[model samples]
Target: MRRPLAEQLPSTLVAALSSAFGVCLLETTGVLAQVLAADSVTGSSATVAALLQVVASVFIVIAVYVGSIVTANTFATIIAGRTRTIALYRLIGSSASDQRRAVAREGLVVGAVGSVIGAVLGTAITIGLVSVSVATGVVPSHPYSYLGPVIALPIVAVVLTTWLASWIGSRRVLQVSPMQATGGAVEKSLDEAAGGRGRSVVAVVFFALGGALLVLGMVIGLVSPLGVLVGVVGGLLSFTGLVLGSPLVMPVALRLTGRMFGRSAPARLAAENAVRYPERSSRTTIGLVIGVTLVTMFAVCVESYQVIITNAQRAQPEVYQGVDRTLTVTVVVFSVLMGFSALIAAVGMVNNLSMSVLQRTRELGLLRALGFTARQVRTMILAESAQLTVAAVLVGLVLGTFYGWAGAQSLLGSITGSPGIVLPAIPLALLAILAVAAAVLTLVASVAPSRRATRIAPVAALAVE
Candidate 1:
């Protein structure tokens, strides 16, 4: 009655990579700040260092937040896959709480292992980079200690967050009745999802409140840049509301996007499969939404900022030239940092897709038994991936563009005297690239699942309980 370590590897890898990325980012920022502050000629070097530290902190938060969500979803899917095993345990007199506690313990162990590995890897990377920089005279040679108590921040944070996320994800265990031991695992139907009207109502309330706050922030922007802070809070609340109501939202979005593909048998089946279980589909795509939204938000904000600066530079080239250069560097740095979150989300998407395929073995097998060819099954899965990615990308782009514009307007409206009147400056090149990336991502993500689906013998897969 033991779970193989391999079953937990995805979540563990996510935790490790997230923690390692955090540590590396922190150390790099710290070292850069130290080098700058060491320059005797730059009087404001200390202040600049403080600002860099703050930016790095924001990046770390984004990474941790994305990583936590991915870890939670991974655990949730794992629990769902183990429904029958858990039910059997329940039949043998095991309590749900005990089983959940055992899962939590497993999570703790996974977190501990990952955090340690990440911390070591991050430290080594930082040391290597610092040594190279010093040797090449890129940075002022100084005795910088990569080993510090500060490193513990990411380690502890990853460990605790992973543990907490696992606990939340395992909530499904409570719903696993011993009676399910006699039946196969199942997901909530559309009707069941719709029956949760209370949750939907709460989601609406939060969303409305957040929308109100966003409007207020825009109005306040007419007077001061501080309004952006309010806008940030509003964005968070509204997004949380969206996430809570995703079961209601993502399916409709998927349906609309699914129509973009030809209505062939495989395509139709793929579309239906995606919406058949709202919870599963919603969770699978939401991570991509978050990733796309964040990346696009930053891109739009930067573009808008550049546009405003360019106009000002035309008026006073000398004064704004340095500012323009600084802005460019800042955007590049932030974009790279934001990429970490996107990567984490990408990992979640791949993990979920893989698990969804694995869990649907019987369903896939049944299709094959019903005269569906392996090629048809593979096509159906690939189509599903394409539709999901398209839906997520579209949603993310819209939300990100709006949020990015709002952020820019809230910050720069006072200077431009336009507040919410300014149009968003979306770079066409970026949009094209995203479109290409989404396509490539879909193909890449679906390959393994499609292959696995095709290779499984119909009789063997159908025999799985």
Candidate 2:
């Protein structure tokens, strides 16, 4: 109960929003399908309805996947913050497994609470919208029950996934030595991170398998569009490997990006601080990476597909006349849906930044005691934020561009009358928008933390446990 609000709000918000998205998406899909099925005018309404359901399922899965990652990251940071307390517990009589299970239970409770609230909100909005649509004659009235057992699925999935994610995140508890109870908060150094060979091996295995699958997907594209499905699996597996190996990967990226700050004292300190704690910096930035990657991947996929469509239309103008409009609308709609996942990630970033600042009170105070000005301290912190954001966005753009190009080629190669390379179409406009949004997010998230860091007296902050 006494845990800081920052520690809990991110996970709760993620759970609630994720469940709400699931419920609303599923219910809305069913309603649309029902309406389409009732439209006796179109002979292919059933097929279209089926497609809608599949797309909705995919969107839901993406949401849950993003939510799970964010939840896990949030819990991992929280566990890091609780190092002192956990070490104390270990020093006395408690075992690591017991402590881990307790954290999982807390996750379960949070998931239940958030899920129920989201489910109720989603149900109400859905019911209200259906009633309005019916009354407005937009669709014919039908016997549709908003309350159904299906709603339970999102609720259950959220609860169970949260539990599982918490367990995964708390794996660090097993490594907390009772001797560390005397020490204050401590984040893993690069050397310590390098020693985790088990994770590195597993990550490499996943990467190898995913890389093989990606190649196979391209080969299969020569024959069928079904290669896109295989590509999706490959992308997921490869991305998982990247996340697992981030402890090793992110530090190098951070060091490279940190150089952009220059050779000033504050700049050097900011650069050093970011690479000083590999785990902390990686956790804080991975969410942004996920967000940017999704947005860019979708943008590249749509633009590349548009390119192919444009060529086809030029060849047969009559058949592809209105297809462009439909494509535009589809991209717009999916982008909005994907935005929710990005929003969840944004919340996680802000939450992690706040917690990082809180955990580093003593470090900041020590710097102050060493005669560092508040402005320099603030600049250092902000610089760290900017450095991480830049690194994450750069990585995301590279990954997303490749994935998007692969998806486009694998899915539409046969449509071009032969299997061939489809050059990726990068949308500069959309990329600019993403970059601007990320910059704003970093600035906004950094402000409060900087203020908090500067406000505390050196002695007072040093006294914090």
Candidate 3:
């Protein structure tokens, strides 16, 4: 029955996507807020209202992009874990196309249901929040008449996103052969599956292009005034390059971290386990990379902007005070909006780690039989989580700092007449706090799976094949 398939599917992914969709739906109220405020302002021009509408639309697009990527990554992890199941179906004479269709159909069903629930929940929450704001006199009373269209947009967007993610996630399922399935080799080494030389070439090219673009953007800022926007674009390209090149980089990083803190048996084993399946580790960390990258990038850029404004305030204090306050508010709001993406990333990491642990039951059981304590097993899981968090945070910080420095030069150069790049003082303590939080969250998520893993007898686990 379909119930079995449903059970195998990741319910957490469904919930995360639903939450993301609900948040996106709630954002539509920004447009409504703008329209209402414009109507109430005695001297507000139609042009100003139209501009606010455009800004709201831009935010919506950004929300959709973040939501789609998170959904796709989560779904892909779930699909990848089922590689053996898909292959078994193929071995029993089920066509690859049929299996793919089944997966896609399941996605559609989940998407539809999740979208409806998200829409309803989002609407109710938004209404409640707005009512409180109105009562507190923080916002004037406004009619809730625009809720209908606002509710529809996220439902449509999420449904389409889920469908696309489902289709894309199934591509790997189709590539898995019956032989690989039977051999339990569905999760092959990245070098073997990706072709070592080809991957290297691609990585090198992307890294070079990204670096070149970043430098070029900085240079352009020295002469032309449009460097700020160019730098931002280049920063994005650079981060994308880093992500694409992670398969090559992850092993080196893992080895270094392992050697540094892997003196203990549990730490050593955890490090080895992570690098042994480099592709899986990379995939598991991609969501975290996306989330952390955005956070660091925004943080650095805002600090740079603050520096520029601080210098300007010395000359015309009153004239720039309003601009400074507006920028501050903008950064805070933007941070809150982007925090949702980070939340999704955390959820994905937890799900991926849990699935990975579950898949290694046989290995864990053998270690146990060989006298590995339950405490050791738990420590190993925590060690792996720590290593992943370190990698993600380090990458984010380095790239974000560079981008922020370039952006500052670009933005300030136009006004100051060829200013040098000034690196913003990043809050290392805050970043450390974030890294620790991520590690703790991942470790907590591992508890249940670790417990399940330890409960299986060695003989039973070894007999899983």
Candidate 4:
């Protein structure tokens, strides 16, 4: 049965309300209890309120980083698939303003859906964690300040922030030219191939510069918060080189490893395709690399931080906690960092694969003309994603596992510390499986775009030239 938009809206609003209430309630429980302990209505109410607000803000920011990237990439591909629809509207006398309105309408839908779900999930997680905290006496249980400034003001602010972020990030809908709409642009020919030496050069140079600055920031302890910003940006920029630089490196790397791909026909085909448009492929690869590096770097930093705190704890108990709480915090923090990183990587995989699928639309059309079923063509595209996920994940797991182990041993094995656990096979395997599954899910997201590409008739594709 089909559901009306109005019906959906009410449920969505109900969901949103439940989400807003729970989000404020669970996260603010600890500090809210403190405020209540201080009576929550005293002159210091304002001060305690601010402290609780800060904690909520921090968690919201984490949600933003983790949630935003996946939403952006997913939305981008969906909207890109709409270029033809948008172009048609323009041709039929719709102004750019009209086109933008359509884009905005779509953006609102996506933003609302994502934010509401995120809020609900975030709230549920907060409640579970807080319940555990209270039971463990990590935080005292008391009534929370949920009625006043604590709930009303911040909920409004968070909703606005979420809607704005999604809207802004999905603004690429405005960039499609009406002339490109007729669906041809989505499946254009090799002769019309784009992205030049300039992009490659820029990516490579940025890669070098980002690396230099990142190393410099690390050396200097990033004297300012600006340093952290620079390191993150620099880390992202390095992928410009790593991805664009892939063809140059990949061919050689693959020449040594090409036979590995030959173990399977699909792998052999996927590898050839990966190298076919090395420049574009590298751009896609660059995105994944950015995600992987950010995650791996942050993962290393977090573990290192814990090791330092733990070693200090080993020497003196009173200096720290009644017991080692750092380990618990470290796991949560590292897991959060990796989840965000892996998500970006997953999105990167989706973005690159969608573009690749689009680029090969004509090929799929031709295959269809030659009697291949639409599902079969879609399978080929999925195969490409599967192959890339396998290859990228294998490399990432090997390197990340080694780096994690080495970093832990160096930081935790000294007299100042007891040797913390290294990359135990179980946890490492779990994370690896999670990363692979995430990459596959990302590939699945592009299924619609791939099917859309396959829908193009061979005649139209050939005419697309």
**Please, what are the lDDT tens digits per residue for candidate 3 over residues 328-390?**
434544454445545655666677778777877777878888999888988888788677767
lDDT of each: 0.74, 0.74, 0.64, 0.49
Off by over 4 Å in 4: 1-68, 136-183, 187-202, 222-260, 263-269, 272-299, 314-323, 336-365, 371-379, 391-427, 434-465
* Collision pairs in model 3: none
Q: Model 3, which residues run further than 4 Å from truth?
A: 1-61, 112-161, 193-196, 214-232, 369-371, 403-422
| Model 2 quality (TM-score) | 0.85
Cα lDDT for residue 22, candidate 3: 45
Ranked candidates (lDDT, high to low):
1, 2, 3, 4
Arranged by TM-score with the best first, the candidates are 1, 2, 3, 4
Worst window of 10 by summed lDDT in candidate 2: 41-50
For each candidate in turn, the TM-score is: 0.85, 0.85, 0.79, 0.60
Kindly list the per-residue Cα lDDT of model 4 for residues 61-173, writing each as its tens digit. 43333233334334444444445666667767888775565555645564466345646564555556556766886544655433333333333433444345335533554
Candidate 1, residues 1-465: lDDT per residue as tens digits?
357876888778877876776787677666655665555533254434544554455445544555565556566777777777777898899898888888788888888898888888777877876787667655657888776666677787778877886677667656778887877656787788888999899888877888878777777776776676677677777887888898898899989988977899999999998888888888788878887887788788878877765665676565443453345444544455456546755776787778777778888899999999998888999899888888888888998898888877776666532323567899888789778877777777787877887688999988765
Please estimate how well model 3 matches the true structure, expressed as its whole-model Cα lDDT: 0.64
Q: After superposition, how far is residue 87 of candidate 2 from its true place, in Å?
A: 2.4
The candidate, 2 or 3, that scores higher on TM-score is: 2
Which is better, 1 or 4, measured by TM-score?
Answer: 1
* lDDT against true structure, model 2: 0.74
